[model samples]
Target chain A: MNFTRRFTLAGLLAVLLPVSATVAQVDSLPSWNSGSARQAIVDFVGRVTREGNPDFVPVPERIAVFDNDGTLWCEQPEYFQAAFALDSVKAMAPKHPEWKQQEPFKSFLAGDRTALAEQGEQALLTLVTAAHSGKPTDEFSKSVADWFSTARHPRFNRPYNELVYQPMVELLAYLRVSGFKTFIVSGGGVEFMRVWAEKAYGIPPEQVVGSSGVTQYQLDAAGKPSLLKTAKVQFIDDGPGKPSGINMMIGRRPILAFGNSDGDHQMLQWTMAGSGARFAGLVHHTDEVREYAYDRQSKVGKLDEAWDEARAKGWTIVDMKQDWKTIFREKP
Target chain B: MNFTRRFTLAGLLAVLLPVSATVAQVDSLPSWNSGSARQAIVDFVGRVTREGNPDFVPVPERIAVFDNDGTLWCEQPEYFQAAFALDSVKAMAPKHPEWKQQEPFKSFLAGDRTALAEQGEQALLTLVTAAHSGKPTDEFSKSVADWFSTARHPRFNRPYNELVYQPMVELLAYLRVSGFKTFIVSGGGVEFMRVWAEKAYGIPPEQVVGSSGVTQYQLDAAGKPSLLKTAKVQFIDDGPGKPSGINMMIGRRPILAFGNSDGDHQMLQWTMAGSGARFAGLVHHTDEVREYAYDRQSKVGKLDEAWDEARAKGWTIVDMKQDWKTIFREKP
Candidate 1:
């Protein structure tokens, strides 16, 4: 769908969903099974949003931050953004023949996941910059939008937009209906996520906060002003950086935070720390039949420290196997 | 007013003004005289917000950014934030008695504005850090709020909040009612501005983007989490930084930008460069009798470059002497 059509559909969804939530209370989060995890979310939102309740939060203070990779959508096999980076590297290989001989790029091109993984953090950074940088921001956005429209996951053979969890989408809509302004505080490149986030999640580009590289404002040869993406890293919104990024971008501390890994640890910690009513949740990938289930020792979306902390902190742990009745959002 | 009371007033204003704007078409901005400058604002807002107009922007796309100091309120004598910093330095002098002999602080403490100005940028930085750092975010917020509640402008002998330009406050409210989301992209400390921006201007803390120092998340001995404001400057949201800050925080180009002085040049340039119904305006401090009028050669809020650019680029130049019927907001 074009931008206009997608925007129109979003408008329709935004209008229809709130009415449904108010009228059809039982099915506000229909994709989720009736469980402790779902109950926690409903109760927290209810207490904070109900007028005259001691725990009621004012509308402006109702901030909800979410992680993108595993919490909102599928991240296993590999992170969706990392997969896009790898694909981009291959597409540009013909122009930069040296990439075939370059250390990590060579292994990446040869489909040697283990070799690329062994090359470590620097190699991943190189791949990300190579894929994302050296374009005007508008062009970069268009590239990401185009990729999302065309690219399909190897396992599911569905577009990445289609891979978003249905329950979480409902939760996002539900939260907004409850007067919570939802924000995506993600480790993924902000430009990449911004292209499709609004269309897929009902979250607008302005509300999506994520990692970004340095962007230079310039007037190109034609005297047309543009913001060019540079290789220099500006911020990395992950782990401890999540809370810091949230503070910098959003200014206000969130009351509700959702994530699925150690990357989201500090975000939840920061949210829970704020005075008054708060809620934090983690989506535990436990349903291998419906979705990939790798967490503790996984290369991507590792869930260790946060998992233990969530249990101890009384954070709702959404067991994918038990809490969610559906994974990928079914096509309309 | 307390935050709750301020919020209630804002809610009331938000409801009443939109109805008034639609019905009372003769004077949407009562403080602004009927002139070319006022006409420009009315025309731009009408074109962009009118349904089915080609230039009509979507409500979400109607992002409007404003500079806080001179644009929104009086910045004469010194920026109000700087005055607060100076007061903070004086307030904390007992504990840090050594500041009596310290270079900038010594000059600052001696009440020698000339000597402090001679010390230049470094002295200003030292003062800001000394005033703002070494406290929890909430504590810092309380300090600012406390100061704003009591601190009076020397000339006006009224609280600084009352010195906000009546016309601009009306403009902010009018824009919001017209489906434009207003944001403050100021050069002042984000924490300082955020403490009272919402209460003072009806712009929320989340919508106020500004310069910031590094903040650290910590848990105290009692296991209470707090964000500590450190002394290191993170980003300066002025001049070239304004556009960058807007991009990072709002993640979208603003359709309209209001600013004053050379600091706002880039922000206006970036806003006007966007491919849409865009508007940029500079508030010229020409009302010397009502308010201090200094521009090109002034020490504070020098407006040489932006003044010239506004004319050349066809950006609206808000001549305060000519445009406004009233300056400071009158107390009820």
Candidate 2:
């Protein structure tokens, strides 16, 4: 039979499949399935992906925005970028004396994690700015590459890059295969994210939108070079800023959004508000053994109010331990 | 017969066929039987696109970057963006007294194209900056959209947006079908190109790199509104800047580069400088009946030095009047 007839038959079969049967079938879906979460994912994927379904998003409109740090990857102990910046500060400390005297810089140099936390967001910003500032974008990129090559996570004892969640990687690839253009919309520095995102996440630099620092291009007798100045917050890519960034950068509202904390709550709200077939997923760090737990009270990647709202909104809550077969890449 | 027997029969037939007869058969390609230029295109495409050819580039790497204004569309009396800026200045003139007193602005208001040209690049920059600066990006986008909707090309009497070369549009789409990512690297403002590029050219905004203005996000005390400032020059996407912009923005060197003037000669050179397979083509305006034909002495989109260099480089020169079956969309 022709495509139209085949599609019609498929549509009828889908309607005839009882909901209870579908739920029961999903419940037996290997050890990788848990709660109602796996069912929600499969059901959403099935309906929108069905050929003649009313909810089918055309390939062009199937854009999905994902928060990188905690959503797509493990951002525990601290955000991976923050950890990168912290190590960068220590590595470059011998070259600059001013950092030794500066408050947050001094605390960082002293390896005082408690003191660094005590300094709060402003202190973290200072630390990032001190390490990431003053160099050309290319030079900073080289530094990041150099550091990432050797840097290992203190607890995992693996290279920081390798600590990216394997399950999320598979999900990203799956979405792309299903005609979604995945974008990393994060609060990290744009230049900082671009340097590693393509290699780690398979998302290109242009598709990554984030907070950025002021940059200037200058010409001397030696020709032109783009220089990065001290971090004066250019645009913060978080909360409502995520939607604004999506508008300015992608110029399209995403159909799917994934987040792990309240920082990404506004993005999810904006995406879910779109009048179309949409999906919102929240990652709940509920496994204390495989990965670090304690979400509501965690200093970083906190899942407070968003967790309750996600439950009420029927957003898929990915229970890390139960939903994932493997947390990171398998050892050779 | 099975595949092995068919392949053997084809090999035997190839050997049995007379060499001179085969040469004659290949030479009888419909367009090639008529002209050498047509033959060149057919031969080049066949050789480079053949699956087993040594020079064959994988479809994924078959990126082609084209200069927009004169290469793919007309830019006669002035650059289209320049014309847009002039119309915008006129529309905004009632609100500003400063423009009436300004030198280049006063000249623009007086409607003298000669005076505007005499103002040179600096004067043109001033005009563009004055017209496009200080507005929010969205407001500028809406202004561009509104202006494009009503503005007509003086010669064609068609909306400026409709004046794109039909042949080039076909070429872009054809290349895309054959696995090429065609990008528009223009001298127009990046934000300006972004507003309508996807709709007009099927090239996403992320694929566009052009001259840019500084932008900043600002929030009012009432927290009611935030805006993106469009101000002084951020980067000029022309000449040496084109290669740098492509590298910094796209992160990949194009295998094919097309241009119509000297400004694009550098871009073509950069593409040709790549180690492996490459192709460079120049769109020569030689049809006065269907389109404007000035080349050597044209003030805008001048083509003097590039003409001689293209010959030396063995780059294909498209004769507009002779080669194209159609010009603008409105043409018969």
Candidate 3:
């Protein structure tokens, strides 16, 4: 109506913006570059959330699941949970002198990754059980919390929690704003993730479904009750287990799913197989400059099968180096 | 100024209120009688919700768990789930011709309760697995919904879903309004309860933790994925299993817990054992006229040891006859 000012687009945007802008900005995912990966996510969310659109899903059924490790954060040198476990093993070694002579334990305590790898999964599981179980749940949670507080990534030299992908964080927040319930369906231990997932990824403990050990209810002489974590592995929320875990926990088919490795193959399949406008994306670790680049050959977070599947299914492959404007939320 | 508007308390309230009242009213639990039972619930909620009070719990931590069967609805003669199971057996009997000659199946089909009871828990479990499992999760949910649509309690001749306790429903609403997250932690099948719990009790599917049989993920030729319910028993959410289920699903110890039988003993125990102001309540069925009153010797929902523990531990024992102004949410 009025041509009082000859303002450039940049000037207009600067004038319209707050001193410190938040998630309520026009560009919802600021950390994500203007790439096909970002566009795919934005388009999917818009189509499903549009009121009069044929693809519009009701708010209740709008469930989006994401795998934690390399999808949301770095899982390069080793999974952050594995680091915690190794730290735990070292911390508890004083209490058990027998571990010095034990096969897996001896190799593990000696920092012999080659020897540990040769021992296979069962040996690694033995180390995990010794490190993660046989304590009260509260104690286990506290230990996890403490580890997340102090433990730094071997490559990043930052707290494990701080290594979370900023673009993914924005995506989670964006999905949540569009009335989608975001859940962490990870291969990581549920107890470990519950301690910090909410703080890092904005997912509550109840919304997280992951591998877990059985916890027993114990009552003390003073009538106080506690859940004691046992050595038994109750459920593994990886690969095929993801779908079953989702059914057991969420009890509904998710419309959107994200992951970076083969561990997420089944979950993405389950999500995509649902009849409707569904979204599944794999975060390809191609950003060697900012993050570790590993695919088809990495010992941890092996991405071969899921990468092929994503391509075959036309699922969005987030070339991390090309797609993300930024990686970590915080600086080293 | 007020002298011109002299009015009785009822007249004042009437004039102050709208034509239709709702949860915003001063008396949060309108269906609850002015007894110690109601007062106990009110007082516990007040202390825990009031800001600046030392006993006040934060909103997120104000988790309330209620056992579904007798705690929230009628479990007389048999559990509503059991009734569903019987109807399912009859509906499925034609498909399985061998059931006519089978011991438990034959006794169940013939409606020989004495013989079925002689066959005991294992026999009943066989019937449950046969009736409930093997179909897709959604199909089983549909079957359960169909049964609920047609089925009614024999004593009251009302739809089974209509038999949810009015007082407890009001309590659930009241607690929810006071910053509490209400959850149904029941001995019933998780899948069965999830189908209706949201509409019936305002608890969402994810918030429900219960007994479950394992569900396997299946992908059809068309690439559509479905979760197929298997006959394998996964977890029992009764007695000690209740607390474990709570731990696994919720990952947080609830502050308030309600139950009506010994099956809920550990849940209530774990809840009360939490630090700070806590509430553990048992709905004592004492209204033989309005609803069946059975305890100690009753096979279904036997309230023996929990009855004694309630007295010993000073847990609120809701005398249904004295405490509830009404029974079911709707009349026959």
Candidate 4:
């Protein structure tokens, strides 16, 4: 063949190459540095998705459950949902005048973290219930959506949605392209997460399994049906509850599970225990310069037990400092 | 044009036509007689699916929920789940000899419907809980699946899975083809229904929302995580709870809802009350020959309030005897 003909053929091949081939050619996990952690994920997905392979999983059974907080986004300093709840409390303080003098409320309003923590879990729960409930479900969802659109992360000074991990976002999209259905199973409030999960993680509200409060079906004065938010705590989707939540909500065993803390240990264990090819991964937030670094002793997203378990079980532990070339999403 | 050319053009048109157009040209609802009820469904689906139209709803919002028992299948003898529970109680009778003397269990096992009914809801619940719980969730699912495969309906002498309404099955597929996500929202055990709903109704386990007992995550002696069934009663996805269950499970308001009894009244109400074009339908069991007929006076699947509401609200009421060309699915 002539040189011009060869060059024309090569140009056509480059243009016509499949997206998967293109992705593979250019680092599939661009935000993730070339490391063992990235390689492990790629290998697991390839094995499970390869047709006629022993590890081949049917498209319907390719379920991947991801923890929302530290795994998908930055949960450092304080959980983003907790911040939303605190902001909501401040917003509603004018209506509930008694909160000005209430035990947990006073400490919470004054930003006295130590005093609020000393008051215990029940007190904290009381403040959460007060701040989050006693409104229509749609109204709560609207408020959450509005908060996400405007609310900025304290440290980064960017919209909370923009603070999501770039590597994890790519992982979610990559799994989806491989015909896996990705879900967010978190310890965070289910309703709160549902508002932004679709836009943030490409997960629909129905695919989200998380902590939830009791909701009652009611009709307004005009007889329009509405789900009213009640103060009653329903299920806490954390720790052992993670698996139970997946069972109750998803009704299928996930093939892959990802999270960052002890709360997701059972979820990962559950995923790994299922028959056929499975994967369990943990994100170790070790990028102190780029992101807050804490493990084994951190108050927020403590990773001691899961860290040891991941190592013992040979599960993938993503070191943010070394494994990830980038942390938060880049501005468009 | 020449006759040969015209014939060839006609053949090409037939080959290129959509399945829906082909269905309409022949019979869209084969089991459903030409009637208002069938027309309503066709109209609603058509209006919402038509692109560039004012009534068009995006595919994501096309949620359709159906009641399981009397609506999807014949619930005449009893709810198939109830019969399964009774059989289960009898199967476990040797281990629990005390059940022979218990009020509900004794009546239930002896096949005394009147005596069991008089014993009240609490007694019935005890029998259900005893029959269903105290095993791992996967094991229970396996047992239920095995039962569905082997167990025959008392009167029909056919496997229970084969007893689903032919008209409804077609409707499910028809709606799905038009971008509707079909779901089975039942008052039966979620785990039990999850076993067969997919095979019987083409709805996946994830889309089946129903009454459930509490489940816990447990690591067995092998240290493998499993969801263990607990005897504690969680939520009953019936009556008003149907709407709440739909809200919590689906996270999206259904555009169309179908049911046959009072238990589904609120579900229909909720679906109808949602903004945008909506359709609510009830299957009236008016055929005594092909399938057993019972409505307001029936012990199981009482259709009193919903019947009245259907008339009052001008919702579609399917007269099973007149509307359906056939009832149960024809054997291959």
Across B1-332, the per-residue lDDT of candidate 2 in tens digits comes to 12353245423333344222333343322211234454455455545555566776665567789999888778976788988987888888899888788878888888877988798888877777777888866688899899888998898888777888776776675455445688998887777777788877788876777776655545457433334656545557787667656654554568888899888877887787666777788888998898889888988888988788899868888888787767775443
Which tens-of-lDDT digit does each residue in B104-173 have in candidate 3?
9999889899999998899988988888898998899999999999998898888898989988998997
Q: Give the least accurate 10-residue stretch of model 4 chain B, judged by summed lDDT.
A: B1-10
Give the poorly placed runs of model 3, Cα more than 4 Å off. Answer: A1-25, A112-115, B1-25
Tens digits of per-residue lDDT for model 1 on B207-272?
889998778878779767677888877788888788778877788999999999999988998898
As for candidate 1, its clashing pairs are none
Residue pairs clashing, model 3: none
Residue-level lDDT for B68 in candidate 3: 93
Per-chain TM-score, chain A, candidate 2: 0.85
- Scored by lDDT, model 3 comes in at 0.85
DockQ each? 0.37, 0.10, 0.34, 0.37
Encode model 3's per-residue lDDT on A12-87: one tens digit a residue: 4433332123223567788888979998998888788765678988878999999999999888788888889989
Estimate the overall C-alpha local distance difference test score of candidate 4.
0.84
Q: How many angstroms is residue B164 displaced in model 4 relative to the true structure, after the best TM-score fit?
A: 0.3
Clashing pairs in 2: none
How far residue A17's Cα lies from its native spot in candidate 3, in Å, is: 19
Candidate that beats the other on TM-score, 3 or 4, i.e. the better one: 4
lDDT of 4 at B99: 72
